[model samples]
Target: MLKDLSPQAFFMGLLTAFVGFASSFAVVLQGLKGVGASDAQAASGLMALSISMGLCAIVLSFSTRLPVSIAWSTPGAALLVSAGAAVGGFNAAVGAFIVCAILIVIAGLFKPLGRAVAAIPAPLANAMLAGVLVGLCYAPVKAVSFNPAFGLPIVLAWLVVGAWKRLYAVPAALIAFAGVLAFGVDIPEGAFASWAQSLGPTVLLVKPEFHLASIVSIGLPLFIVTMASQNIPGIAVLKVNQYEPNPGPLFATTGLFSLFSAPFGGHAVNLAAITAAMCAGEDAHPDPARRYWAAVIAGIGYVVFGLLAGAVTGFVALAPPVLIQAVAGLALVGAFSGSAFAALKEPETREAAAVTFIVTASGVTFAGISGAFWGLLAGGLAMGLARVARR
Candidate 1:
C-alpha cells in the first residue's frame, strides 16, 4: 500500500484537508454557539467533528480503497442557526444530533427507510436548504454595514479570489478575516496568551437531554439536510469519478462516527461533498485506484487541524461577531446559490419550491417545529394538490 502512495496524492490530500477545514468552520462555531454552546463547548464540538470525520474518512478509504472523504454537515449547522436553541438548550441539541445520527444509521441498514428518505422530492429538499441559508447569505452585506473597514476586505477577498479560482475563495476570505481580527479589531491584553494556552485538543462531553420539540425541530431537519445535501452528493461524486463503493456501508460508518461525536457537541459527520472531489479527482492522482491514499492522508491532516480548534475558536471569538459570520457567509454563498438554482429549475415543481423557500426564509416556528419542517410539509402539500388537480 505504501508503494501506491505518490507525492501528488499526498499534496492533494493535505490541500483537501486545508480547504475543508478553513472554508466553513466558522459556521460550525456559530451554529454551536447559536444552540446555546458556551465558547468552550463550541470549541469541543468543532474538535469532535473534525476528528470524527477525519477518522471516518481514514477508515472508509483505507478499507475500501476508495477516496471516501468525510465532513461535518455544514448545512445542518446552518439549520441550527435558523432553528435557534431548542427547548432544553445545548444538551437538547446534543440529543437531537444523536437522533439524526441514528436515523442515518437506520436508513443505511434498512433499505426501505433509505429509499423512503431518497424519495423526498429534490426540489423541496433544495428549497428548504436554500431557505435556511438565505439569512446567513446576507451576512456579508450586513457585515459591511456594521463596519465596512473590517467587512469590505473580507467580501472583496472572496469576490476577487472566487473570480480567479472559485475553490480558494472562501479560504481567501478566511485569511482576510484573520487579518482583520489581528490588525483591525482590538484584543484585550493577555487574550493571545490565553488562546495559546488553549491550543491543544480537548473534549467535553455534553450529557444529552432529549425533548420531543428538539427531536422534531432540530433532529429531523438535520437528518434530512445532511442526507440530501452532503451524503447523497458525496456518493454521486464518487460514482462520477468511476468509484462505486456500496453506499449503505459508507453511510452507516459515517453515522456511527457522528453518533460517537454527538455527546461532545458535534452535530453530524457524514460523507463530504466538496472535499470528496478534491480527493477523488484526477488532481489527487492520475491512477484512479491510487486516489484513496489522498483521502487517507487528508484524514490525517484533518486530525492535525482538529487539534488546533481551541486556538482557532479562541482567536475568532475575539473579533467582532459579524466578522466571523462574514467569513461563514462567504463560504456558504456557493452552496446557497446552487441549492436555490436547483430548487427552482423544474417547471412543474417551481411554485412549490418557491413556497418552500419563502416559508423557510421567513424563519417561522409553529408548534415547536422549525420553518424547515413546516416548509417541507407545505411544499409537499402544494405538490400533492397539484398532482391531484392534474389527475
Candidate 2:
C-alpha cells in the first residue's frame, strides 16, 4: 500500500513530520517552566506525548482505514507559557492539565459543543485560522535578519522547492537543514559540556496536585484556550480535508491521553492541521484508504524524535536563530495568506473577521488568556448580533 503512493505523497508526509517536530522545539522550554521540570522530567514529558500521539495516529489510521494524524496541541503549549508563569509552578500546571482533561471528557460525552463548532461557517472559520497564522509568518523573516548566513540557505531552499512544485513534498526542511550544514554555521562553545550533566538518568515523573487557586488561575484558562484555539480548528481541518472521523472518539482519545500524561507535565493533545494536510493530500496516496500509513509513519517518527529530547534541544540550541525564524516564517506564509483571504471573503462577515484578525494580531492578553480567544469571541458575537438585528 505504501509502495503504491506517489513519491510526492510519501515525501509530503515526511515533510509534514519534520515541520511539526522542528516547529515544536521551542515549546520544551515553556513546558519545563510550566512544570518546574528537571531536565530528565522535561525529556520524559516530551517522550510521553510523542509516543502517545504516534500510537494514537497509528491505531486510528488502521482502525478507520483513513489517513489521520495526531499531534500535541500547539496552542495548549502557548497557553501554558502564559498562564503557567502565574500558577504555582509545575505542580499547578499539572492541576490545570487535570481540569482540561476532565473538560475534554465532558465535551466528548455531551456532543453539542462539537456539533456547534462543526456548524460554524467555513468563511468564519477560515478567517479565524488566518488570524491565528498571521503572527507565525513573521518568524522566518525575522530569523533571516538576525542570521543572514543561516537564514539565506533556508530561504533559498524554500524558493527552490517552491519553484519546482514537483519537489514540493520533498521535505524542504531537510533541504534547509542541509543548507545549514553546508554554510558551516557555528555552535556556541561549551553549551552542554558540563559536569552537571548526568550520564545515568532516572526518569522523573510528576504527581498532579490540585489547588483551587491554581485551577482557577491556570487550569480554566488553559482549558478554554486549548478548546477555542486548538480543537475547534483541528475539527475544521479534518472537515476541510473531507475526512469526517467521529469527533467524539478523537476528543475522547486526546483527553484520555492528556489525563494520563498530565501528572508528568504534558499539555493538551489534539489533531494537527498542517501535518494532517500532508497526509490528506492526493500526493500521499491516491487511494485515500491507504493514506493512513503516512500518518502512522509520522507518528512513529515523532516518538523517535521525542525520545531524543536532549539531542533535539542541543541541536536547536546550535541552530542559528535566524534560520529558525526564517523556516518558521516561510512555512507560515501559505497559512497566513489562506487565512487572511478567507477572513475577508464575505461582505457581511468581513468587518467581524477584520476585527478578529486585528485584535488577535495585536497580541493582547487579559487574565493570562491570549488575544486569539477574545478575537474570535468578539467577532463571533458581533456577527451573531448583526444577524439577529437583521431578523
Candidate 3:
C-alpha cells in the first residue's frame, strides 16, 4: 500500500487536510458554543470530531482501498447553531446528536432505509446543499467590504491560484489569510510561548440528557440534512471519480464513530462532500489506483490537526472573526458552485431546486428547526406537486 505513495499524492493529501481544517473548523467550534457547550466542552468537541473523522477516513480508506473521506457534518453543525440551544441546551443537544448518529447507523444497517436515502431526488439534495453553502459562500464578498486591506489579498490570492489550478485556490487563499494575520497584526513576543503551550486536545465529557423536543427538532433534522446534503453528494462525487464504495457500511461506520463522539461534545460525522473531491479527484494523483494514499495521509493530517485543536481555537480567538470567516468563505465557493450546478443541471428539477435554494439561504426558523430542513421539505413538496400537475 505504501508503494503507491508519491510526492504528488503526499502534498495533495497535505493540501486536502489543510483546506479541510481551515475551511470550516471555526464554524464547528462556533456550532458547539451555540449548543451551550462550555469552552472546555467545545474544545473537547473539536478534538473528538477531528480524531473520530480522522480514524474513520484512515480505516475506511485502507479497508476498502478506496479514498472514502469522512468529515464532521458542517450542515448539522449549522443546525445545532440554530436550534440546539433552544432545544434544552447542551446536554439535550448532546442527546440529540447521539440520536442523530444512531439513526444514521440504523439507516445504514437497514436496506430499505438505505434505499430510501439513496432514493432522495438528486436535484433536491443538491439544492439543499447549495442553500447551505450560500451563506458561507457570500462570506468572502462580505469580508472584503468589511476590511479591504485584509480581505482583498486573500481574494486576489484565490483568484490567481484558481486561474492556475482550481484545486489549489482555497489553500492559496488560506495562506494569504494567514500571511495577513501574521504580518498585518502585531503579536506579542511572549504570546508565542503561550501559543506553543496550548497545543493538543483536552478531554471533556457532557452527560447527555434526551428530550422529545430535542429529538424531533434537532436529532431528526440533523440526520436528514447530514444524509441529504453531505452523504448523497459525497457518494456522487466518488462515483464521478470512478470510485464506488458500498454506501451501507460507509454510513454505518461514520454513524458509529459519531455516536461514540457525542458524549465528548462532538457533533455528526459522515462522508465528506466537498473535500472528497480534493482527495478523490485526478489532481490528488496521476494514477487513480493510488489515490487512496492521499486519503490515508489526510487521515494522518487530521489527527495531527486534532492535536492542535486547542491552539487553533486560541488562534481564531486572537484574529478578527470576520477575517476567519472571510477565509472560510473562500474555501467553500467551489462546493457551492458544484452543488448549484447539480441542482439546476436538469430542466425538470429547476423549480424545485430554486425553492430549496431560496428557503435554505433564507435561514428561516420555525418549530425550532432550521432552514436546511425546511428547505428540503419545501423542495420535496414542490417536486411532488409538479409531478401531480404533470400527471
Best by lDDT: 1
List the lowest-lDDT window of 10 residues for candidate 1: 194-203
Superior candidate under lDDT, 1 versus 2: 1
Question: Candidate 2: where are CA atoms >4 Å away?
Answer: 1-45, 75-86, 119-132, 166-186, 192-244, 277-290, 320-323
Candidate 2 on 343-388: residue-level lDDT in tens? 7988988887887777666667676555656676777887898899
Provide the RMSD of all predictions against the true structure, rounded to 1 decimal: 0.7, 4.7, 2.9
lDDT of every model, 2 decimals:
0.94, 0.64, 0.82
Instruction: Give the runs in model 1 whose Cα sits over 4 Å from its true position.
Output: none
Model 3 RMSD in Å is 2.9
Q: Count the clashes in each prediction.
A: 0, 9, 0
Candidate 1, residue 355: Cα displacement in angstroms equals 0.9
Select the stronger candidate by TM-score from 2 and 3: 3
In model 3, state the lDDT of residue 44. Answer: 85
Structure candidate 2, residue pairs in collision: 9-283, 9-284, 35-90, 130-339, 139-325, 140-325, 140-326, 140-329, 143-322
